[model samples]
Target: MHFDLADLRLFVHIAESPSLTQGARRAHLSAAAASARIKALESQLDSRLLYRDNRGVELTPSGQRLLQHARLILRQVERLKDDFSEQGGDQAGHIRIFANTTAVTEFLPEVLAGFLAARPAVTVDLQERLNRDIVRAILDGSADLGIVAGPVRAEGLEILHFSTDHLVLAVPPGHALERLGRPPTLADTLGYFHVGLHEGSTLQSFLREQVERLGGTLNLRIQVASFEAACRMIEAGVGIGVLPETAARRHQRSMGLSILQLDEPWVVRERSVLVREREALPGCARTLVELLRQVGDGVVAP
Candidate 1:
């Protein structure tokens, strides 16, 4: 019924690695010590927490729930320590952020570079995630902040306008799609082969969802990791691609790519920043949020 931070930390490592030996090594304990700890945890909780197999270990449902709580607890403890350290003039902190693909690849890099440059003792852990997932992570205390596009469903989290962007079709100049004499809709372009973003990209997932809603599939000829790569492929006439207008415009002239506006309502995207509570955030995290707002407002060029 009672366990310490060490127990929670050890459990998290084991669940993440799914290897007793590796988890033990990470916790600076031997395999036997780690195994004993796990057994003690299971007995204390009165639940089976893992499933063992030749491959590795898998968390049981109970273990999955525990993992979530453990992460949240550890994060809160870190935040407390960071607050105390900063107040003591050490100014050391770590901020975790979850953002969608556009924010990750297009928006945050320049802003983060400036933020990190001024605060050498501050570190950021930025990750790309789906919009909804980003919102959930913020609510769960797993992420200090989030940048997401489209509508946000987070009820209690603070949402600030981040930026506005639109998805556009990028094709080779004089391509068949460009010759349509009008802006082509996503449905119209589905028939053509397309260069797409990587499978895990939020933008790529959004495109697929839209395609499915229209009862069609994206005819992707190849998948690349970035908007630039997609534009390069489109310029080579490999296939057409959907890209954020901001990114597409940057490469349009150099790549000889034609940008076609999509005739769908969802094409227009609004990005927002989500925070649990502004006043409750660590000092460094609050500063970063302010910087993000400035960039979003065009006070600072990104």
Candidate 2:
């Protein structure tokens, strides 16, 4: 039998609350209107739906069965409306994104600006977290896309390499490492006290792996959770650190710190763009990914 979604909505609301008065309150209808809708639905189905008693309302056997179907039908109807709205081809829906600290602060500004300029109707929401957290957002469908560092592994997700950012050595102006004319090897650099961020960061992981590959380990003097804290310690001559070039440039002059390009063997970290499905990406999300590719084209050589 065919029934209107409005009828099903009223039924579910009544079934959930089991009290016509409360259901009407929840659905923003008067008692008479709610009872009328429920009676109409019961007539259309040719069955007794509810039994009235001192406990307010109780469902008949048929009513209990129809309640489940009503909930499913209402959910599908809502999904259909959302799908059609998003397919309106107006580029005027919400898009959520996840990104790491470096990308959020240093990389996405220009790309996001260009996107907002072109698609004025679209609204962008962004959050900053570590690479793993960003990946989790995409997998759980909480974010439409994610920008992160290397080593993302998930089924049905396509990872695209967009840029490669080197980890530069930053030292206080008067620090021993700053007195050297040329950059030192990972081994030689570790001979001095080292300041670094805590271990969970992708950048920190990358540095540790590279150092281990060269048969050495960092003598970390202090490990803080934030890059700003690490930079502060480095500026105070507590030790040297390997930080992103983008971040280093932002605070180097003001913080009285100097950044030196490490030797060729120590170049670390490559930034990547990730999407759940490249071919089926939403229109606005696809556009943003393309813009990032264009901007970082020369930054990462293939």
Candidate 3:
């Protein structure tokens, strides 16, 4: 049977989108054209791929099965592109690295710098995402590698222990919580306004979940995108903030922000690097993973 990549790509897009119209737009096809293509594909396959109605299309069992393989095939196609881009044996390829705020902020820069210096022909595209989102991107074939700030399901991925990240609450020096010498439980501070990361951030999600577990609700005063922003908001006396230890120390001595140890075991976050399986990574991406794995490359001790 002849399989068309274009049809498969459109099918994947349609399956992901809320409506066939939206998916066709994303694929740069007119609704009529896209509909025609899908009809032809269904005829060729002798199966219904979608249940179409006014609202949207739902994937049939056959469409669902095809989506799984389509994603894998497209991922392999991207791999082929990266693997073939070369210049005189000096690896020339693009690697996409998706990481959570902690790994992106504290760990990856220096490591990536050294790797890029050695492999000058390789290009790195780094993006910051929440930890679980990073895992999803990797599993869905959208990202070549991922660095997440905690353990996640590793069903089909190769894992690398990257670093240890400890979180502490940052408060303005004279804040009410600062008067107490003992570490504060999350419940103790739920009454105060908080400087939180972005709403959908992994750290923010964890904090919110913990607050819920403690039978309290988060009262966020402001939401910023990074630890630096949160620290700055804290320094401005806006509200208390949770930050990585690396950031807290760097800012504490200068910003005069007081670091309060979190009285919870989960505050110490473990970071890990994940890939589609070590061998599946292209040469350029694999090299970077090796650099992360190298013991002496400042891999923080547990």
Candidate 4:
């Protein structure tokens, strides 16, 4: 029973993707070729790997174990390549980061721009994901680093303080909530129609969870894709919105929106950086982490 690195790589892509065809595309293989390879791999292991249905494929128990090992092995292989490249005076590599919406939209761009400018040989694959998914990706070796908001419960991961942000309500000037002259709890704003983030946004999902916990539902007047759009809608008096304080401040004057603090514990949020093992990270990845730490320290304003 033997499988090559290519087979392992393909399997990893397939397991991570939504469909076999998509996985094949990621691996730069035709669908038929990828299917044949998977079959051969299953035969070599003497176990079924994936359960196929109309929607897509789900990994079998055996496939799940293989995926775990495969990701670890691939990460090790990439590290090995990085080490050799560094020895040859070419410190070039790719780093994958999974971050939440706030980090993605409000924090990372400036930092990433400078980092990329300095390290011409390094490439970054940054993806927006939910905090929980970010933690899972780091633990599973699928992501080199993660920036997550709120509490983290991952036992073995290294957590670094990144930044602090708050969820604030964005209201039009002279809105009823604004006239109240006090920090309003989420419950207090439940009756007002709201401008909300897109349905797929992690922040939106988080807000929905909070609303459900409070035994209320959002009376959404409109749903937009970004903080800016939500601010625009709020400024137009379509509705109020819950947005990051960082974003609210940035657009407050221009958008003529009032930013109100929420009287809730969860409104104050801490963003943290996560890694499986910092010392074990690739050289380029480690450098990126340090740069992020500098930003957190206020040594460099991002």
Best by lDDT: 4
Q: Which one wins on TM-score?
A: 4
Show model 1 residue runs off by greater than 4 Å.
Answer: 86-90
RMSD (Å) per prediction: 2.4, 10.4, 3.9, 2.1
Model 3: ten consecutive residues of lowest lDDT? 293-302
Return the clash pairs for model 1, or none.
none
Over 24-69, each residue of candidate 4 has an lDDT whose tens digit, in order, gives 9999999999999999999999999999888999999999989988
Per-residue alpha-carbon lDDT of candidate 3 for residues 1-302, written as tens digits (9 for 90 to 100): 88899999999889879999999998999999999999999999999999999889999999987887887787677567766664522366778889877767666787777777777778888988877778877787767899887668878787788567788889998888877778987877888999998877778888888888887889999999778788889999999987888888987776868889989978887777888877767777776777776633465321
Candidate 2, residues 81-167: lDDT per residue as tens digits? Answer: 444764454355556788876777676876778678777777888877678777866664556688887566766678888778877
Q: Which has the higher TM-score value, candidate number 1 or candidate number 4?
A: 4
Q: What are the models' TM-scores?
A: 0.89, 0.60, 0.79, 0.92
**Candidates' lDDT values, in order?**
0.86, 0.75, 0.81, 0.88
lDDT value for model 2: 0.75
Residue 239 displacement in candidate 4 (angstroms): 0.7
Model 2 bad stretches (over 4 Å)? 1-90, 117-121, 132-140, 151-156, 179-182, 209-229, 264-268, 298-302
Clashing pairs in 4: none
Q: Which 10-residue window in model 2 sums to the lowest lDDT?
A: 74-83
RMSD of 3: 3.9
lDDT head-to-head 3 vs 4, winner = 4
